[model samples]
Target: MTAPVLEIALLQVRPGQTPAFEAAFAQAQSLIAGMPGYVRHDLQRCLEDDHRYALLVWWETLEAHTVGFRGSPQYQEWRALLHHFYDPFPTVEHFVDVTPGRLPPS
Candidate 1:
């Protein structure tokens, strides 16, 4: 069995485009949810910055996101719907469970 991985991205919506971007993301999230090995995800808006967001996606493995999702055609649609809203574009990173005994932090 493979340990779960967390895919994190800091999303910075273009000025005045937060609402539009959020609407698009609402439609695009399903594409990620339906993929193989997908666990769950959360999209959170920064209280300090309304135009900034954090996307935290949990997958069964890194490849489940980097290979399965990004390599699929659905990703194209996902990109089309949400990519343009980004300002400098977000940097996505992957992380693994670190705590040895307790449940991972939410």
Candidate 2:
């Protein structure tokens, strides 16, 4: 089986917009959750900076997110709901496990 891919996005919301951005994300989360090959996701706020967040998503493969999710119509809605809240916009990247067996059990 192909190893899963991890998507990471360091988001910086415009100052004073964190509350609204988080509300929008609550609605947008379902769009990603229903996509093909989606494993799981999490949104974590930074303690040092209230305007910063980390978005992590696990997919069955790279294409499952880069192609399947981002290319879908749902992504448009996802953008509409959450994109405006970003200041400079977030950079998204993907990764594969270098030591899969080293990960602690969930």
Candidate 3:
């Protein structure tokens, strides 16, 4: 099946809260990694704007992301741990990878 593409936001925690945010994110990673159909994930820090960050997650299908992941217990943990880090929950969008690059080797 063709994979679904999702853009995730890595909420910018204020400077002093970096440690707290990282610690929580580290804890959530294990749970997220265990979910079904979860293909891969990447964390990126903004080079031009240090305060900004993002997560890119690819799934085997949209259901794998919205229903499988978002509705699972792991998602609860993921949200509880990470949601607060965002000053304002950044926007989330989905798109097709028409001219995609090489699939990342996990």
Best by TM-score: 1
In model 2, what lDDT does residue 21 have?
93
lDDT of each: 0.93, 0.94, 0.75
After the best TM-score superposition of candidate 1, give how far the Cα of residue 67 lies from its true spot, in angstroms. 0.6
RMSD of each: 2.4, 2.3, 3.1
Candidate 3 worst ten-residue window by lDDT? 1-10
Query: In candidate 1, which residue pairs clash?
Result: none
Instruction: Return the lDDT, model 1, position 77.
Output: 94
Q: Judged by lDDT against the true structure, how good is candidate 2?
A: 0.94
Judge candidate 3 at residue 57 and give its lDDT.
80
**lDDT by residue for model 2 (8-83), tens:** 9999999999999999999999999999999999999999999999999999989999999999999999999999
Deviating ranges (above 4 Å) for candidate 1? 103-106
- Residue 98, model 1, lDDT: 70
Index of the highest-lDDT prediction? 2
**Candidate 2: residue 13 lDDT (0-100):** 97
Could you arrange the candidates by TM-score from highest to lowest? 1, 2, 3
Sorted by lDDT (best first), the order is 2, 1, 3
Instruction: Enumerate clash totals for all models, in the order shown.
Output: 0, 0, 0
